[model samples]
Each structure stands twice: as C-alpha cells, then as structure tokens.
Target: MLDESLLDDPEALARADRRELLRGAAEAGARVRTAVRHATEAGIAELKPDGRPRAVLIAGPGLAATGVAELLGTLAGASCPTTRLTPTGVAPASGALRWELPGWAGPVDLLLIATPDGSEPGLELLVEQAYRRGCSVVAVAPAGTPIVESVQGTHGLFVPMATAPYEPTEPLAASAPGVLWALLTPLLVLLDRTGLVSAPPEALEKVADRLDSVAERCGPAIAPYSNPAKTLAAELAEALPVIWTEGTSAGPAGRRFTAALAELAGRPALTAELPEALAAHSVLLAGALAAGADPDDFFRDRVEEAQALHARVVLLRDRPAGGLTAAPAARELALSHDTAISELEPEEGGELETLAELIAVTDFAAVYLALASRA
Candidate 1:
C-alpha cells in the first residue's frame, strides 16, 4: 500500500527516492535547454533542408522513445506519414530485439533514431540497413556508444543526448522521468528544420520555462493540498487510473502518463481519448472497479488481503471548455457510476509548451508514486 503520509513529509519522500526519480523530474526544464544546445552544436538548427522527407520513420526502445514517436507524429499531422518502427523479431544474437525497415522504405524516407542508451546492436544494424536503402538518417543518443559510431560512419547526422549534471556520476533509472525531454527536444528541433514541426528556438525556450513553472508548483516541498502532482498521486492510491485526454496533444500526454505510471511506479493504468474513453471503459465503471459498486469493499479485511482497486477518471485537457471537449459528459458518467474524477488543464501557452506542462506535472506525479510506494 502507498504511504499517504509520505506525500507530505519531504524528508521521508527524499529518503524513499533511492533512485533519484525526484531529481530526474526536477531537472526536466534544464534537460530541454541542454538538449537544444546539443541540437545546435550538432547543426540541426542550422540545417537548410532541401525539403521534407517523403515519410518519417522513428526507431527506438523504451517508453520515452514511444512517447517521442507518438508526440512527433501528432505534431507533424498530415504533413507526411510518420511511423514508429517496432521490433520485427529477435536478432541473430539470442533474445536481442531487432528492428527492420519496411519493404517500401527507400531513398526519400527519413529515419530518426532516439534512444537513452546507444549500445543496442540492433539499432546499429538498423542504421546500416537505412544506409543501404539510401534513406536519410538522423539520430540522438548518448555520446561514445556503438550507435553513435554507426550513425557517423553511415554519414548520418548525430546529436548527443542531453544529460543532467549528476547523470554522468550517478546511476539514474533507464526509465527516468527527465530522459523523455532530453531525447525529445533535439528531434523536435530537427523536425522544425525539416519544416515538419514548429518548434523554433524561442518556442523551445518557452517550453523549458513552462516545465520549470510546473516543477515549482509540483515539487515535493510543497504541501499535497496545493501540489497537483502529489494530490493526484494520493488520489490514485488503490485506484486504477482511466486517463481520458482531450485535444490533439493531450492524447500523447495521456498515454505517456500511463507509461510513466507503469514504468516508474509499477502501476497499471488505462488510457483513451475523451469521447472514446467514455465507451472504452464504460464496462469498468459499471463493473467491479466502480467506486461504489461493492458495498462490502469498505469492510473487507485490511490486515489479511490487498486493497480493492477502483476506477478514477483523470481528465487531461488543454483545449477550451466548449466544442473541443467531452469532459463534462465524461465527468457526469463517471460520477453517476460513483467514480471520482480529477481534471488538469495547462495554463495558456503554445501547443508544445502546454503539452510539456501536462507531461511534466504527470511525470512528477508518477515519480512521487514510485517514491512513496514500495513493494
């Protein structure tokens, strides 16, 4: 069970965060700035692209990469096809995952690689495959890894992944909260250079500022009643989060939240966009997971068994309250079924900034959950 008391006790929270998850989350804004600097040094910001690629293919491992692919595709909507490459199967080496280009991928396509760790042999092979196919390739990864050499040898653009000050000397988790922004910021700039996205230098700085503001509001030293992240973490105790997001950007943010919850906290969650989530999880609201469905739930043996998991609707919106939202109906339906709801909408900003805000707040929430709860 999650120790709710730890949510307010800063010292205890710090002691419990053995992996430095909180530090990772607090450095998100710094990561973005550092990542942009890396992109600049790599010449992504100076590139004069001939034109946009025929298609964009993203390849990587881990939830952070999954988030980058999803967010980039959303931002690059309708410009051209953007697909995330999944593993085809195991490589020749035992149990190593392999990624292959599609049969149709050719010279006009662009291959983008983003990974926290750059040692994957399969990714090295993927680089060679793209080179042989005559496709353009750009990659962002940690310095001095095998993939870095592969990309450089293949004559592809390579940007080093941004790392926080302590990252070089400390052992952060592979799924650390800040890794997402470090891996994502450089690519956003690269795509901006390609005329596929609108993340200019100033806008990226704004994103960094937005993230810092969220950290200030949601940091552990703040009281749970005032800290949105801590409050959300507390509300989610013994409950399964049904993350329902509204807006083009919110979809990726919602999915990333579930991924973070699972990776950092060992928490299972369900995610769907606003209108679709109402139906996708309707059965859950009406069934055993409903907060009030089982009256006997309250009197169950607390000492002998695990707590029952109920459904909590977390509505994330960056859009206005009117035509663009189904949040009201979602709240009504969930409440009618005795399911509680929590809502978070970012302050006014551009798409990327607002999206970063949502992701930052939830990232902190996931970190708090991981720190406060132990197996």
Candidate 2:
C-alpha cells in the first residue's frame, strides 16, 4: 500500500528516496547540457561525415541501450535506417549473451553504442568486430571504463556518459532518470551533423528548458491536487496501467513509462499503440482487471489485505499522424468498460521538446511511486 500522505510531504519523500531517484529526475535538464558539452569536447559537433551511412547498427546490453536505439530509429525514419543488433551466439563466453554484426553490415554502415555500464566485455568485443568490418563507430559510456580503451583503439569516437554530482551506486538506479539524457544527447548532436535528425544545439537547449519547466511543476514540493506526477502515482498505486499512446512521439514515451515503472517503482505495466491497443487491451478492461468486475470488492476487509488491482487507461497524446487522432475512440472504449483514465497531453512544441515533456512528467511520477510506496 502507498502512503498517500507522503506524496505531499517533501521531506518525507526525500527521506524515502535513498537511491536519490528524485534528484536524478530533477537533474535531467542539467545532464542534457553536460552531455552537449561532452559532445563538443569529443569533437562530435565537428564531424564532417562524407555522407550518412548506408545503415546504422546499434548494440548495447540493457534497457537504456534499447531505448536509445528505438528513439533514434524513430527519429531517423526514412532518411537513414537504424537497426538494433540483438545478441546472438555460438562463440559464447561462459554461456553469456553475445552480439554479432549482420552479414550485410560493411564499411558503409555506422555502429552506435550507448550503455550506462562500460565494463561489458561483450560490448567491447562488438566494437572490435565493427572495426574489423570497417564500419564507422561512435559510443557514449562512463569515463575510464575498459570499453573506452577498446573504442579508442578501434578508431571509434568515444563520448563519456555524463554523470550527476551524486551518482547512485546501484546500476539500475543510475540508469533510471538523468543518465538517459547523458546517453542520448551526444548521439543526437552527432546525428544532427550527419543530417539524420534535426537536433541542433539551439533546439537541444529548448528541450533542456522544457525539461526544467516540467521538473518545477512535478517537483516534490508540489501537492498532489496540483501536481501531475504525484496525482499519477496515487492513481497507479493499485492499478495495472494499460498505457495507450496515440502519437508517434507518444509511443516511445509510453514504453519508457512502463520500463521506468518496473525499474524504479518495482511495478509492472502494459503498453500498446492506439488503435491496436484498443483491441489488444480490451480484454484487460473487460476482464477481472476492470473496475466493475467485483461489486463486493469495496466491502472486503481493508485491514485484511491490500486493495485489488484494476485496469487504468493512461492516454499519452502528442501530434497525430495525417492530422487524425484515435484518442476519442480510446476514451470511449475505456469508459464503456467502466475503467478510469489518466491522460497526459503535451503542450505545443517541437518534436524533441514535446518528447522531453512526456518523458519528464512520467519519469517524475515513477520516482514518486518509488519513494512513497510501502514495502
């Protein structure tokens, strides 16, 4: 059970944030600036790429890497193809996971790597393979890791993953909040120069500014009634959230929310894109997870057990495709099944800024859930 009172108590929330999760969420904007600076120092901005690579191959070990690859792939769309190289194996080390380049990968391909942990031997070896294939490579990871040496030796560009003033000791905690920007910003800078994306430094500054504004609104000091993040945490305390995203930008943000819920809040969530989501998640809304499924649920002894979980539809909306929106139908479907809905519609902005806002608010909500929930 969650202590609702804790959501309004700034000091209590801080005390519960032993891993400094809240701090990390608040520092997202700062991390973006730091990352941009790192890219400049690493000469990412000065790259005079002969041209965009034939295809982009990205590889990494965990959630952060996959999220980066997905976001980059979405942004790169038709201009350049971005593929996440999944780990496969025959030549395996102690039966550990491995990554191998596809047969078609060659000199014309570009390999991008992003990881919060730079010590992965698999990733280091992947760099070697990319070098041997004559693929141009670029990576961002913590400074002084073995992967840095491997990347440098392979003649790949290495940008250090920016860190906060108080880096968390736990790896998952480290990856949850601010580190994503650190991993992503430098890559955005590089991609902008290569003409695959539109994230110039000024546009990136707008993203940072947008993030800071969200932090202010969603900060611990705010009360639940006025705070979107705290309100979301309270709503999700006993909910099995069925996150439905209605825009291209919302898709990545919705997926990120589920991952953050699991990683930071120790909660599992389900997400699907709009029209497909209506059919994919309809069963959940109509089944035992539905609000009206149990008439006697409310009369059950509150002292004996925690509240029963119910499906809650979290609608994340951004710009629509071809000016068409599926949100009205989604809301109607949820209402027809007697399910509660939580909607997050972004303010008007460029694609990167809007994406940053969706991510920031959801990130704060996850931190609130992490801090205020009882074990």
Candidate 3:
C-alpha cells in the first residue's frame, strides 16, 4: 500500500509533484467550466449547416490530435463518417499533396483542425491543403498564432482557446486536458447545431459540475481512505496496470487514463476494449502463473532470480447502462493468477458528465501515484 499519510499532507504531496503538475490538475474543473462558457458565448449556435457533409475529417498535431480524434470518433459512430490525419512524419509542402477525398469539389467535406498553440508544420500543411481544395475548415487555436493567420483566406471557423490561468504544456497531465476542453467545446457546439449530437447548454454545465465533484473527491486534502483516486494509486503501485472499458464513451476515457498513467506516473499501462482484452489478457495471466511457478523445483535457481510479477487489472465501466461481455471470465482468470483488480465507474449523469468524472479520477490517480512513488 502507498504511504497513506502523504495523501492528506499538502506539503508532502507538493514535494512529490516534481514538475508542479498538480496545479493544473487541481484547476481542471474551473478550466473546463471556462471552456464551456467561452464556447457558448462565441455564438456557435448561430452557425447554419451548409447541408450535410459527405464525411468529417479531424486533423491536428501531437496530443491535441489524440484528444480531437477520440472525441470525434465517439460522436461520429454510426452517424457521420469520420477520418483522422496521423501526424507522424514531415508535412508536405503547400499544394505538394492534393486531397483526393470524394466530393471534396463541393461543400461535402468538413475538416476540423485542432492546434492548441496554433503553430505546427503538419497542421499548417493540412490548412493549406484544405484551402486549395475548397474544403470547409473549422479551427480551435490560440488567437494571434500562425494557424489563425493561415486560415485568414479560407472559408473556416476559428474559435480562440479559452483563457488559461497558467501557461500550458504538452504532457497530458500538465496541460493537454485543458486544451482538450478548449478544442472540444466549440466542436460540441457545432455538433449540437448540426443535430449530430445532443450537447445542450445544461450538458456543458453538468460536465463542469462533474469535474468539480471529482476534483473535490481527489484533492490533496482528501484522505486516501476516502479518496478513490488515491486508493486506486495504492492498488496500482508496484504493479503493471491493464485498463479496459466497454462502450463508445468509456473507450476514450480508458485511453485518457492510460496516457495519464504512462506520462504522469511514469508507469506503462495497457488499454483496450473489453471482451477482446479479456481473451488476450487471459493468456497473459496464464503465462505469468506458469513463469512464477516452481512445481517440480527443477529450475528453482532460475525461478528465484526472476523478477517479481505484479499485474493489476483496472476496469472502467459505465454500469447499468452499458454491459460487459467477458468481465466474468476475465475476473476468474485474474483471481486465479492472484492479480489485483480495480474497477472505476462514473457517477450517474450525461455522457459528458460521465466522461469528466472518469477522466478527473484517473488524472488524480496518476498524480497521486507519482507522488506516492517519490515518497
């Protein structure tokens, strides 16, 4: 178990936070609320749909792109066809690569560009491509950045990033969550306007409220015994965490958790959809059991020298609404191998509220895990 005493000691927790990431984590609620207010006040509801597009393309660079891709993918399911641009390699020069998307010649393709800082070579290339192809583009970026300048000549909508209390960073824990909110806020507004998704004004407020509740529950002053995030951290310490979730909304939430664990806690976590993960991880658990056993004592020397195997399962579920197919089988396998399990479920609310709850909890867990390990 983690040093539970540190969970309630602000000084000790601050010391454990080597990079001062906790400030950003603590303010996540306010940041999200601001994002919602900003998007609502920006007059996105006034936008008129220029007919339904053939497909939606979400493009960006770095962690910003990941957030956009996840949210867009979730909202796009069975409603609008969607594609994501992978920001891996060097971007092509302007007009060097022509987009061959079907129906690009007309107002049938919508490209949403996300660049929090508004300056990236690949994203710039994408903007240029969009301008050349006469594709409708929507952008979320900081005002006065290169991307805003680049979009001057195009038929694009630009939503400036909401005011941040501090300078943001690239790591998920440091700044990505806030930026994620900024990018998603306007998109949610547009989705609502298009009848693609239902994100009422009250929905945004509910999401913010959910985040606030999570922040209070996971704050440093909360005792570990009462704090779900801290408790999860204690369970995850000295163990490899395998995070899985069922349902469209929870899938992205799981991915965000893995990213936080890997980046903030410096712990590698595996994330996957359920049932499929059950089968694959079942084999893994069986392998760990075989590796750790010394049934015949013939290879006792090698067995004794082997590193300790500590695998933990973390299941994120939206229960009573979405059901799991192989949770029972997976639980049986994990129990047989003596692997610990941690399950996280969001408080009852809308999709955004549930997502905010899961994300806030996991974010605090990652930070607490990092602090506890340092201690």
Candidate 4:
C-alpha cells in the first residue's frame, strides 16, 4: 500500500511542490487553448479566396496520409478540391483548377506538404515546385526548424512538427489523436464558417466546441489505461513483448486483458520496450490468444534467450476448444476458457464469481483501474 503520510504530509515543502506542479499544468493548458484560438482566427482570416485553387495534400506513407488527406478534404469543401499527392504521382483531379507538380502541366493553387523532420530532399523539391507554380505553400514538419520562420514571413504557413494537425508518431498515444484533432479541426471549421467556403461561424463553432468538450472529458479517462504510451511503459518494466494489431471490430478485448493484469498487479501498467530491471526475474509469457497474435515464436525464441529462465505459457483461445496443445521444448503450456472481455460484450452477470476466480488462480499484488473511451 502507498504510504498515506506521503500523500497527506504536513511538510510545508511537499505542499509547495504539489501546488507548483498542478498550477504549472493548468497554466500550460490555458496557454495552449489561447494559442490555438489565435491560430484558428488567423487561418480563417487568410482563407478568403478570390478564386478557388486546387488544394493538394502531399503526404508521406502510412496512416498520416489517410488521416490528413481526409481532414484537408473536409476543410476545403467545394471551394477547393483536395487531392493526395505522393512522390511519384501528380495530385488528384477534382475541380477546375489544376495543381501541377514539377513534371505535370497545369496551373496550381495551394499545396499542403506533410513530411517528417530531417526529410530534406523530398520536402525541398516539393516546395520548389509549388513556388515555381506560384501557389501558396503550407509545410507541416516536426518542431525545431529554422526554415519555419522563413515560411511564415513569406505568407506561407509552417505548422510545426509537434502541432502538425495530424497524428504522426508511432506507438500512437490514445490522447494524441484527439488532442491534434481538437486543435486542428476547429481551425478548419472556422475557415468554412467565415465564408471562405460555405458554412456559418455559428454552426461551425457548435461543432468545434462539441469536439473540444468531448476530448476534454474523455482524454483523461483513456490516458491511464487505453493509451499505448502507458501500456508500453508498464510492459517494459516486466520485460514483456508488446504487440500492436488492428481490431477487426469495435470491441476492445485485448485491452481488457491488459487492464485486468494491471488490476492484479496493483499499479499503473503499460506495454513498452523491455526494461533492464526485469533481468532478475524469470519472465513469463501470459496473454490471451484472442488478441490474434501467434505466441509460439514469441515464447520460444524471445523468452528462451535468457540463460537461466523458466516460463509458463498460457494461451486463452475461444471456447469449446479449451484444451492443451502440443508444447515446445522446455515450455509448460496450458489452455484456459475464453470470456469475452471487450467493453461491448454483454456482462456475464457473474462479476463476483469472475473476481473470485481470478483471485484464486493468480497471485494478487495490487490493482488499479484505468478507463479509456473514444471521442
């Protein structure tokens, strides 16, 4: 148990430390809100178009392309046709205005380039092509670039890498996508609201405000449990393997297994890179096979590498087939009954029975509950 004295210490220094940290976080949140509002207003103001230009979204590979392209299209509306452009192809055709790159023969309007930091050659060529075509260029790069200043001064928008209005980082945090969307979605809505496209400010504000409110409410709830950030961190401490796969359905059964583990462990658990502290213990591979991951190699090759180690491999496949399978060399394998652990799955009406069973079968240490919900 955590020491109550540490939480309720009478020491003047401890009180001051707590106060400062909370105050700092509050102040930072307020500053971010204010800056976001100002940026939104400026983007709206500049969006007044005499003639609509073809809007091209030049994106790198992966989820970044799909996410950002859809967002740009929504913001552009009918005023500008938004298309995705890659390194090898011309921008898509969707309107009267033709957005040409270096090799294409057409007029240009606006080019939004999404690339990571230190990717110089591709970014430079894209920007040069846009400049030659006399199109307004917007570059989204990771933070800490001196070139952003030049872009800003020349009537171009340089959204820093950290605030690129897109989810770019890997092992994506549960809170990150919402935060980015909350900040960028409003600015895009504002553009349409201000008659840059064809929407009213009142309508757009209502939508943006609702999005902001949802994010503010659900962000913290999901931060501790559903977040890949927290999960990764906890898994690292246990020297466990963390595998991330896409869900075929809306339910989250795999996450529930991790959450249950966290409750039994009595701490905020996470999945992350293997930690050095776990070197002493014989690391065990324990996870539900329903997570759609193959456990055979994960246990044999990865876990067996430790020179002095023992492992109990438990595979929880879906029921009626709850029996032991052939085991690998030196591995104790077991099979368990499957219970639908997804949030969408109806409760079994046996909460007490389940809890009691869990306690009896596993060693109890500490338990913590982390809740996560999407906005």
Q: What TM-score does model 3 achieve against the real structure?
A: 0.85
Tens digits of per-residue lDDT, candidate 2, 1-375, equal: 788999989999888887878888899999999999999999988889998899988887667877888889888889998999887665433136578899999999999988787887888888999999999999999999988999999899999998877656554553488878989999999999999999999999999999999999999999899999999999999899899998878999999999989888889999999889999988889999999899998799999877789999999999999999889999999999889999998999999999999999999998888788852
Q: Global CA lDDT of candidate 4, please?
A: 0.34
The residue pairs that clash in candidate 2, if any, are none
Q: Which stretches of candidate 2 lie over 4 Å from their true place?
A: 88-95, 172-175
| Candidate 2: 10-residue stretch with minimal lDDT | 88-97
Write model 3 residue lDDT over 52-161, tens digit each, in one string: 67778887655556776777768667788777765554353322322333444445678887766565655666677877787888888777888786776575777777
Clash pairs, model 1 backbone: none
Write candidate 1's Cα lDDT for 1-375 as tens digits: 789899989999888887778888888999999999999999987799888899999998867678889999999999989999986555523138689999999999999999887888889999999999999999989899889999999999999999766644345555677898999999999999999999999999999999899999999899999999999998998899999999877889999999889878999999998788888889989999999998987899989978788999999997743656788799899999999999999988899999999999999998888888862
Candidate 1 CA-lDDT value: 0.89
Instruction: Highest TM-score: give the candidate number.
Output: 2
On the 0 to 100 scale, the lDDT of residue 68 in model 1 is: 87
Per-prediction TM-score to the true structure, in the order listed: 0.95, 0.96, 0.85, 0.40
Q: After superposition, how far is residue 159 of candidate 2 from its true place, in Å?
A: 0.6
lDDT of 4 by residue, 273-305 (tens): 112112212232333322223435345554445
Give per-residue lDDT, candidate 3, residue 177. 45
What clash count goes with each model? 0, 0, 0, 12
Off by over 4 Å in 1: 89-95, 168-174, 298-306, 320-322
Ranking by TM-score: 2, 1, 3, 4
